[model samples]
Target: MPKQIKLNPLSIYIHIPFCVSKCAYCDFISHRVGDFEINGGVEAYFNSLKTEISLYSGLLEKSKVRSIYIGGGTPSSVDGKFIHNLIMQLKSLANFSDEIEITLEVNPGTLTEEKLNHYIASGINRISMGLQTTNDQLLHKIGRIHSTNDFMTSYEAIKRAGIENLSLDLMFGLPGQTIKDIENAIHLVGILKPKHVSAYSLKIEEGTPLSESYQKGSITLPDEQLERDMYHLLINGLAEKGIMQYELSNFSSASFESKHNLVYWENEAYLGLGVSAHSKLNNERFSNTSRIYDYSKLLSEGKLPIVEKEFIDTSEDLFESIMLGLRLNKGVSINKLNQKYNIDFNVKYANALENLLKQGLVILTEDILKLTIKGMDLSNQVFLQFMED
Candidate 1:
């Protein structure tokens, strides 16, 4: 059983590792269901997950669940009954807030009216659908299993199911994406008017097919200037549609922001379940085994299946808190940092802060320190400045 500790309202993340097909740029721990009966695998996995949840029942019963995020290799690809059962089990084990946000990540290809209905019945109040791009040819190039029509059908079904809280994932910097492609996507999203939007730039992860193609000169990406232009265009476009950019890549209208993701950016504790899942609790971080077979084997023998664990110390904790907190538009509270860490935030990194301020990359007020527009664009460099020796 996991350790029992009192905390503020906790968030839960459930990983689903099954997908219909792997995208060319994907490197996450996911299995493609090709000619295999996914039901059996899903059942077995859920069984293990239940056992894992049971191990934390004591801690859960003592804590109120603030949010639940069901994510992964196309969570919509699996049977909705499995998801319903998982939510039911969690509810049985925990004290869920009446207004708790429960979100499920979905793919356009796997959505159905039946599934959406089941999801609604299961207490999933939010749907995050991946509609990476509106270009059918670009979608095909990325090995996406859905077309624009499929996305439209799924989106309509989500609305018909009475799910008002929706989040759409869009991507730029694709293999052949253009400014027009992004404009078209943003326009479509504007028409749909989802509560939230996550606009990201595609990165060619090493060892993925996309990276291989990039190295072989078969894949060409937008130049740095063009990519920057696309990012700004998306920001301006979404803003014009009344979507507030709350974080670097996430935008929302009023209270429709992603509560579960905010847990991470706020540096709060969360519990992760299933294969390759990660958890941060009690000032420690740990992760489950990545291999499904290994995860199953350990769980079957009544073990926790933890493959990695790190006990965060004070310095590391402070660093992480600042690093993650800076990702948000609200930025980090200087007062909170001083109160918690007992260090002069300005003095510790005076030189770095001076250089960043001179470049108009950051702003430091009496109570808050945050990235400016130029700072967000060069956030990586800003983040590097805060690293402790």
Candidate 2:
């Protein structure tokens, strides 16, 4: 008998790049539905997505998919039937693990009970809802379409639908935001008791509406000290709610950590579909075309629609492993890294390790190297130490 090839576990991320309205701070590749609705609507995009999936069917057949994350400019903004059909199509093509986790990212004022029902029936076991802040004034200031009431209604509906795996996304460090606002948001988390919380500090990306306004001096964000204060408050507040810190900006209740996100942080291989999506498979990392027309045109020509690709050489791979692994609280197992890379971790990274240790950034307990709380705060600085200079 011929030797059997070992199959690897995979994760899938499907992007729904349609939004009801764009937020001021967002830099994600998403189009307003009104503009695209006239030009063949989302149906055209879904067709192209199916084509992309078909192109990867052989690869899918060789891997067992463990997680599927349907993210977008509010995936719930569109008709639920489209999402249901898409999930069914993927199921037909891939060998899904029996304990597969399917997550759908939603926005408030867009999700209805009927739409949520469709998602539940389609096997979406997890829902990540965006509730940037509870203040209505802040919602308007940030150009968000939903109010606190809208988020409350949508959140309650998800709970009533019996979908227990819920994750709430919150943002700090917005213009005109105060400590009181963050306190209120944290209090709401305690009251709501969500399974997971992702608290991120705002970064004003260049060319974004918020960034433009900031550049014009029309608005001013909280100072560096205030932002740091807000982050520490988040860490302390979530702990009081029994949501322990697992990653730098993520908190979860017990085993409720996001498996799909873990795949990325663990440097595992996964496939990303749809326009502007990125993927790391085998030894190469690649991304699809960001333009809708270009994506559809290439797919119609029976091509992969990939616009960029790069091979992750062993040196780059090791650095990535070290960088991503440190993002977790448990940190990386040096023994495993040594075995996989065939090197002594201490000897190979002695200089970097010495610097990190002296700076109180990282500590190695036995064979595991993990970041201290201070290191987590200054994670970018720590990652820089591991780079091949």
Candidate 3:
């Protein structure tokens, strides 16, 4: 019998930083095929990832691994058996508690049926596939490899594999996008009936081709009013399908909420391995080096690639906890606040909270504090107060 492990978060994240191609809008540290110098680079990448994973055995001891999230530029770009071997190594090193969540981020066009079965048989129960939009023109404009039809086939295959939990990623406010486009996307979502959905607005980040186009004024985005209308319609339309918004971006049906993400927003501690992964261990924050060569070099030399670590200070701790806690629909617990922080959380941010409350953005009660409808709409404004530290 498999040994029983405790039911806390000893979660691990493995980064597979290779992709078939880079999307125009993505700036993640993922290398396309022609970028690698070494002949056996995929082997080197896997070995480097395992070397990093081994460094944590001493740190985690026998803690129960509640979840494992294998995210990337695109995890499916790698061989599924390599992932299976990595999962096997993980199983031997630390015990996975019953109900451990293992998730892989996939691109719809990249996976094959045989590999999909290997992923399921290898113990990946949850799959998060990137399906940015149903509109083919928008997809082409964004330089995504997959069309809407490709996502459908991939979705059908996951069902055929007998894997149950699935997540579909959606984005809005693309350059030259309309509210009608978003509405059409929602109708497509209803037909798909995915168990979970994550919706994000397109942001123009530096070092991305999309940002370059925006800087050149070669593309025009929907106006702010239109963007907000799109978001509102997105929430209401998904609600019609019984997928309730659990976090700002994630919506889920009963028991389908993302366990690994909750590890983040709830401020629970977890270990992150591989390049560019971040970790919060016992109120301390640490991030790995972003460059793959640098990460590989350091691990090959028996050194940690950790670039930064900060111990949580008092005011910083309170604000961080509150900032993270309010992202949930469940809200923040005022009693837990007084217990954990040794100060009234309300008064520390009382003025700011009250100002937001008056704006019909945040709601406060005797025991709980949560974002109101208006607050969810203006969540960035609410979260900005916590960024002062």
Q: Please identify which of the two predictions, 1 or 2, would achieve the higher TM-score against the true structure.
A: 2
Residue-wise lDDT of candidate 3 within 161-259, one digit each (tens)? 877899999999998888888888888878878889999999888999999989999999999989889898888989998899988888999889999
Highest lDDT against the true fold, candidate:
2
- What TM-score, computed on C-alpha atoms, does each candidate reach? 0.96, 0.98, 0.95
Clash-forming residue pairs, model 3: 361-375
**Worst 10 contiguous positions by lDDT, candidate 2:** 33-42
Give the poorly placed runs of model 3, Cα more than 4 Å off.
1-8, 386-389
Model 2 segments beyond 4 Å from truth?
A: 1-6
Q: What lDDT is obtained when candidate 2 is compared to the true structure?
A: 0.92
Ranking of models by TM-score: 2, 1, 3
Whole-model lDDT values for every prediction? 0.90, 0.92, 0.85
lDDT of 1: 0.90
Quote the lDDT for 115 in model 2. 95
